[model samples]
Target: MAAESRSRILIIGVTGNLGFELAKASTAASHPTFGLVRDSAFSDPNKLQKIQNLSNHGVQIIKGSLQEEDGLIEALKQVDVVICAVASAQVLDQKLLISAIKRAGCIKRFFPSEFGGDPDRTRVSNLDHGFYSTKAEIRRLVEAEGIPYTYISCNFFASFLLPSLIQPGLQTLPRDKVNIFGDGNVKGVFVEESEVAAFTISAVDDPRTLNKVLYLRPPGNTLTMNEIVDIWEQKVGKHLVRNYISEEELLQKIHETPYPENMQMVFIYSVFVKGDQTYFDIASSNGVEGTQLYPLIKYTTVSEILGGML
Candidate 1:
């Protein structure tokens, strides 16, 4: 196939919420969007529903698994842009995505599966079970190669904290309650998943984001959970529960469970209660700093997001 214009984008993991949204936006924008589906899926009806919904949005689905080398390579050949929206826990599969993009020989840009907290030196250790290392390794391999890559180390997804809203129970850990890191004053960029896709495409479209580890960050209005709860208390019209936990205890829980979901629990236990601002994003919210193209991040507030959802 002849090389197409910059408008063509192939978004892998298209069935997921964020991927699905990006595909729709890209399609609405008139950019041809393709979705990659794993032929051997390990899920259920809702997941299938999401995938079927993609077809409704006019996204082309290429059935293949990241584990299938031949299949991945075949799918990569169909598009110039590739977004690995696969799960971070699938560290092994990430390597395959990179290899497939290379094998296709048509890919001009490759967006890795990283769409979460900063994996930079400061925050990587705090990321859930092995996800940080997996992301770091992928980024390392990309740097060594000549492939154009963008690592959107988008800071904490605000929506990821929705559990605390429905089940205020998570906001306070009764067991070995040592909240936040130290004094519970660490600030982090809390960008919504929706904003992440937008920022990602913006960063990817501008050639400057290529080959660079562009940190996808929310405009930091950094506030502790205690501070945030005060605002929420007013909104929910109830006394919000808040607590402080030691980082050491949180790490101990992680040491005990070591499961992805548990690791996330440890993180939530740490961030909201203890309120650590140790994490920071490299991508400038003002403009794409240091590169030729200026990339600006649009920050979404927690309340604003919840309001829309409710």
Candidate 2:
């Protein structure tokens, strides 16, 4: 495919971890990619580095804010697809972005910032933060406005959890004790960040994915927490202490922990305990399994990703 013929993609939150991967994948796929950056990114050292890296990759940077209607509309005019990769804290804030998309009236597809669990299925609304509710609201707005969109439900990030062996707040792979949420048998789909970006970019122009949730539950990547622990044990040639956090204990943690951390606990409960990701069937009316959509795209399994870390 020629660069000029490909869709012009504009990513709203390009400085984030997943956002950067999306930008790289878009450019790699020869799409004329654009990044909507804020004025403050130029001042922040880390973000400035990422901006420089993105510019080097041929992503045309359009300096604008989601809050600024005129600037956002101008940016929207230049792209066919708009993908928002903002953090969970900024999910609801995308309401403003959706309104801007409507006003611009040119965006062919809008990928809202929902790269985790499916918000509609996950019942975490009563928690301190409105993570699920906010995402659900954004989905409603996108549908109500009749914006052609794709919701990427990539579930757990392999890079985030696999690094620490699913142990919260630990950077290194645990050598001794590990917290096994529930019986550790509940399954979840874990995808590498780059793989998520690759599959997401592949579906950008795919008609099958339009207005449907792209569930990234690759067969090799789906596994129980206990199965993940067994993989690590095989790699280390030793068994670690498995401290089980019972369902009741996890509920207490959700109630006791503070914001953000508590939010993480809520997600843990939803995926690990409630079996939300694997429990539902993807009806043809709502979703298309990503691996099945593009069988040629090889995804790195959990074991392979963990082995690379060591």
Candidate 3:
């Protein structure tokens, strides 16, 4: 079924920053969105409000915890496209998601949550997080089942680097001090959240994106952390401190942070540094530049992403 003709698009873990944005983008185009929330407590209030904000715009809020089979079954009812937007949902449990979708049996397409790093990398052989491993498993199951699915390998979120971390959240940092995990010159792809959402919506809307890793990301231009730090400092008119912390130091300091989540953040960054994960040339892969994600394709450059933030 074409996306617009479908009754609704179901977004699992809708109460997240990216999930909500994807729903809104689809709904804005008159495509009804069905969002499955894990539960009340796990749901983010701001993201919830964002959905309510779209109430008039045509979004269906379905309360379903990923832990409950009935919840997944009910949430997916009438869903034509399923977008898995969860973080750290283990591979074992992700089976529950796919099984439920199979039970619903109407799901035509799905977008896996492989949002960072290339799975083709040898470093991926050692991927440890429940997030990476779960996505890997889900992809495997989809292939085995011959279910229609799209694996979105977004390079990295630009916001993840600075606003989310590399700077603590609890206190206003004295400066946007950046920690360079690699040689401050590694060229890596980082995308803005809106750009990611736009590309995601386009993925489901376009049929050619199915059964492919619709690597929908912003401009492939990558910038070094040092370059960004320098520009932000210059634009903001202050020398935001730059700390060259060792991998060992970061691992230790992550424990020091009050946020328990920092531990995972540290590990993800460590993988980004050590893994063979980098930007892909989308124009060459799957034709995302032309047919899959034509209009929503946004390319953000290092200087522009940083300078705009400043």
1-310 per-residue lDDT for model 2 (tens digits): 6668789999988998999999999999999999999999999999999999999999999998878888888899999999999988888778888889999999999999999999988865677377788899899989999999999999988876678887777889997879999999999889988889999999999999998999999988899999999998888888999999999998987787887776667777888899988888987439999999989889999989888977
Clash pairs detected, candidate 3 = 38-65, 219-299, 219-300
Candidate order (TM-score): 2, 1, 3
Ranking by lDDT: 2, 3, 1
In model 1, what lDDT does residue 238 have? 63
Instruction: Using lDDT, give the best candidate's number.
Output: 2
**1 against 3, candidate with superior TM-score:** 1
- Give me the displacement of residue 75 in model 2, in angstroms: 0.7
The global C-alpha lDDT for each of the candidates, from Candidate 1 onward, is: 0.61, 0.89, 0.64
RMSD of 2: 1.4
Any idea what lDDT model 3 has?
A: 0.64
lDDT per residue (tens digit) for residues 192-292 in model 1: 67666766766656667777665543343346555455545655566634455566665666677746547665556545443332343344332243222
**Candidate 3 residue-wise lDDT at 182:** 57
* Per-residue lDDT over 1-310 for candidate 3, one digit per residue giving the tens place of the 0 to 100 score: 5544744688776667777778787786567788776556346677667667656567777777667888788777767888877775433566878888888888888876666665544243332434455566677888888788887776667766544324444333235555566556544557776667777777676677777776643433455556656656766788765667665665566666655566444544544455344444555554344224575365565567656654
